[model samples]
Target: MLGVPKDEKPTWISRLAAQPAVHRAIRTFRLQELTSAALKVRPIKRRLPKSGIEYRVRYLESFLMADEIFQRKIYREAFEGLDVRSFVDLGSNVGYFPLFAVELTGRRDLVGIAVDGNRSMTDETRWHVDHNHLANVKPLWGIVGYPSDVKEATFYLNPSNVSCSAQPVLNPDVPSKGRIKEVTVPTVDVASAWMQHAGDVRVDVLKIDVEGFEREVLRTCGALLDKTSSVVVEWHKWIASQDEVEALLRDRGFVRFRTISEDPYCGVAVYRPRAS
Candidate 1:
């Protein structure tokens, strides 16, 4: 449906203008921070980038939180300039990037599968897909991680953020990484979920952003990787070293296309590999 804009709109300013001052005052502490946070977690309705279809969007909570830590646009740019007709989004947070990438493929026949451990986030993803008249996107909620036979595990729900991860968190300054309460969620084997939701379609883009569970998830995804054309991953060094991550990609015939500094502890990698 679309690609990056030739002249991107100054979204930060508009996001602030759209929010009433009373709401911002009640939830937010400063105006500059609100504008800065307008970059990634968009919860507003705008035309779906290039789809020419008006969508009902759910931007991140505009109240009680000032910003989003995850930069969704970086993933958008990573998926660009590819032949991605279909995609799989792991750790799908309210289906932001998958929906964006669905528009990016500019293909009406594409299949989009969004997976998340959080039920609420999955519901939101499903709602966005259905309400936007997009029959291509599907949202699946279950626990998925590095372990193959993980029957069940504790899922940390960050009440304050959309990206509540699977790992135990400490810092409160990082949005969802803090204020977590553990709850048991049903686990789904990655391969099983892939077979069930993805069916037989070739997935062009396989994205993994499972907080700190990237290693095991990637380790078991060799066969899926063999069929995938590209990958977008947020590899955190705290969970696994960068050297280890790079080596894993190298062994799998995935050449890193772009690397964006996400933080001191984490980095986003976009990869292109041989079409098997």
Candidate 2:
């Protein structure tokens, strides 16, 4: 897929010109004043309180934004009744989901392998893991896909935003403003990588949120699905159709599982293969 162009200044200007009237109005507002007001409403330096776990949780609520809440909800539902020994967190942007999983499972025996195509995100994840003294998790930097050995692809680096995918996807309706950098990285087959590194280990839960590349990763990891007890994926609308993903999983013996959220844009689906 074509990465964002090296000379993205034109694209950035075009994006600004295409913004909706409401967004344009917001941009015209006193930027610093708006930022100050937001900070006053929710300060960034607020720390988790030192108290009982319940009190700490209450304090933590001040820190969690919308995405964190969504991640927590899915983590709870995915591992509710099962014993999760190992978790494979693909596209683990800041390791928040993996950390949340560790806290939810409450198991020191837990092993987490967090992978992302962005090196900076992986570094941040590593820092967060070490800062929290999480000994069981390992963060890897790479893209996962069907062609494991493929070495070169245009990678789009969206400033400090690591969750943004390197894959080329254009939405005529949505406008974006920012510079993107070109990067080259190694891509691996999910199944082969897991087998090589996590061979003897059984994966209890696998969570994937690779922007638009989820289907490709699944295709590459077909051999490892049998050992996976459950899979949770945030399907991308631009890459593969829902019916296609469902059929692919069905052929592999998995059944569609629902999530609590109704937002189809970021639908979270769980799958468990039928027992023989």
User: Model 2 clash pairs?
Assistant: 148-189
Q: TM-score for model 2?
A: 0.73
- Tens-digit lDDT string for candidate 1 (182-223): 889877675666677668767788888887777767777777
| CA lDDT of each prediction against the hidden true structure | 0.63, 0.60
**lDDT over C-alpha atoms for residue 96 of model 1:** 64
lDDT of 2 by residue, 67-167 (tens): 24332344556675688888888887756666566567665447778888888668857865676666877888877774645765656665324335757
Candidate 2 lDDT for residue 11:
35
Supply the global lDDT for candidate 2: 0.60
List the pairs of residues colliding in candidate 1: 1-106, 42-59, 43-58, 43-59, 146-216, 146-217
Off by over 4 Å in 2: 1-72, 160-163, 170-174, 262-264
Residue 196 lDDT (model 2): 68
- Residue 114: error of model 2 in Å? 0.5
